[model samples]
Target: MTPHATYPATQFRIARPTHQLDAVVAFYTEGLGLPLLYRFEAHAGYRGAMIGLPGVGHHLEFTEHDDGAPCPAPSKDNLLVLYFPGRQELDVISRRLEDHGVRPVAPENPYWEKKGLTFEDPDGWRVVLFEGSFGGGGRST
Candidate 1:
């Protein structure tokens, strides 16, 4: 008998601080093209928004900080790696981000054939857009 498989990695969320929730929502929705799934403003001044692809469990949640507590700035040591379905889409999204005033950093062309582009978000977090699997035919951008 074959063994049963269970539980695949489905979703993730990140927290960030911002005084401009509306602008941040616009960036994720209009600029990145992620659909707004939900927004909440609790009584204690807690606020958040969830953005994601339609029909997929994948999502990103941006939470606003209360008590005037400052959220730490993003560092180079921490990065969010995003994988697109293909290289073509990666290029398209990269261009879109640039058009929205978010310039992508230098792409990483690993010898293993994976290519990726990095960029910083409004809160200074590093987001890396990557495509392709490790080891195989490599193409130049």
Candidate 2:
């Protein structure tokens, strides 16, 4: 057999401008259930926080951009998609988000062979919770 190779994404980070860092933190930590990994004062009168997820080799870093620099508008350009191991986990996550008053943009269901839910962060960053393989007989174009 030939030698095998593996590639995995380590982490994801984004700089978000917000007038309410505390509220953002609460939304990400308490609302989304991601653990606050780190927080620090950034340059030019700003702050940031890194949130970690269990089992996934990825973490989300939120940075506060310079004040009065025109808070970046939300878009569908880039999104942060998270995958769970199964449907039960997906349901639990969706319920938690709802309990925290975060309405999911797209509720959970089996689509493209996976059960999942979709929503946007306070800063308009797209977040998703999916479970299943997007391969084999069922795939989306």
Q: What TM-score, to 2 decimals, does candidate 1 have?
A: 0.72
lDDT of each: 0.70, 0.68
Which digits, one per residue and each the tens of the lDDT, describe model 2 over residues 35-72? 99889896677688878777665676666765644657
TM-score of 2: 0.70
What candidate 1 gets wrong by more than 4 Å, as runs, is 1-4, 7-12, 106-114, 133-141
Please name the candidate that would achieve the greatest TM-score relative to the true structure.
1
Q: Please provide, for model 1 over 71-119, each residue's C-alpha lDDT reduced to its tens digit, 9 standing for 90 to 100.
A: 6765554666666779899888888888889887653334212477777
Over 4 Å off, model 2: 1-12, 55-57, 107-114, 133-141
Q: TM-scores for all candidates?
A: 0.72, 0.70
Error of 2 at 71 (Å): 2.7
Model 2, residue 121: distance off in Å is 1.4
In candidate 1, position 57 carries an lDDT of 67
Backbone atom clashes (below 3 Å) for every candidate: 0, 0
